[model samples]
Target: MAFSSDLDQITRAASGDRQAVSALVNRYSPGVLALATRMLADRAEAEDVTQEAFIRAWKALPTWEPRAKFSTWLHRVALNLCYDRLRKRRDSTMAELPERVDMALRPDDALDQSERVQAVEGAIAALPERQAAALTLCALQDHSQAEAAAIMEISVEALESLLARARRTLRTVLMERSEA
Candidate 1:
């Protein structure tokens, strides 16, 4: 149903239909933004990646062959952009200074919950890129295993392996944090 709807919208969008383009953006922008945010851990960078992905999508629409689901292809594009950014980070020689946490400040329940969420996100951000991507797609975003696998351009088994490793690492990291 989504596939067909997307195809219709894509067709309309290809012919410079503003409503169709708006509909497509409204439908997919949040998802693209979320995926980029999870992958990059930087809201600004994620927004940039989302905008770039849409720009690329618009360009491709005219010649777009429906070889893969539009969502899958768009996600792959976003993921690749993420990979490029990650690579750039790795290539840079400067080490980023860690943000200081004020452990001295006591927190209310809401602040505690916020801290917990930050902990989990920090753990996820520490993961290897592929593992992080798998966990983000499957666990955070609720994508089906098949869809996540397609987006990552990996076999389902490979995706499962990455997820397993990510889960294990998160468990260990969170447990250690709790103990501290």
Candidate 2:
């Protein structure tokens, strides 16, 4: 995912090279899917968003300029798509929150681990959208601070602020859950 490799792949893919396309997809799809899943909190909707993001990527390739890293651009596209879906859901009269699932693990250790993961994820899903995106990109997805800020179209300071708030919120929520 280096700058040069992305440029090379984008050039080849833009020329309709199937191998290049596959390589790009294999490299980037997981990150895209993970981001969408975290943001949407629905596997099916996340999958749809992932597919649509790639489709948009394919369409944009021909006219793509290297103003930003390909991954950054792709992620930005996916984030915007998530925003659109979120807005639509907010506007819809029938939208309802998804129910939480209980995982019944046999071992106490495994159950504790699963509950911790679920608690963190649920807390994240409940965060403000920008905060969630900031945390997901910088912490979970391991994007560089500059790259993440670029993706979110915000300043590094703003991103740091969002990350701090997100961490504080997650800490408070998870602590309450653990105490309960």
* Top TM-score model: 1
**lDDT tens digits by residue: candidate 1, 101-147:** 22222234344666666666666777889998999999989688999
Q: In order, what lDDT does every prediction score?
A: 0.84, 0.86
Please state the error at residue 180 of candidate 1 in Å: 2.1
Q: Report the poorest 10 consecutive residues by lDDT, candidate 1.
A: 97-106
**Residue 133, candidate 2: alpha-carbon lDDT:** 96
lDDT of 2 by residue, 81-166 (tens): 99899889889856554444344422343557766566567777778889999999999998999999999999999999999999
Error of 1 at 134 (Å): 0.2
Question: Model 1 shows how many backbone clashes?
Answer: 0
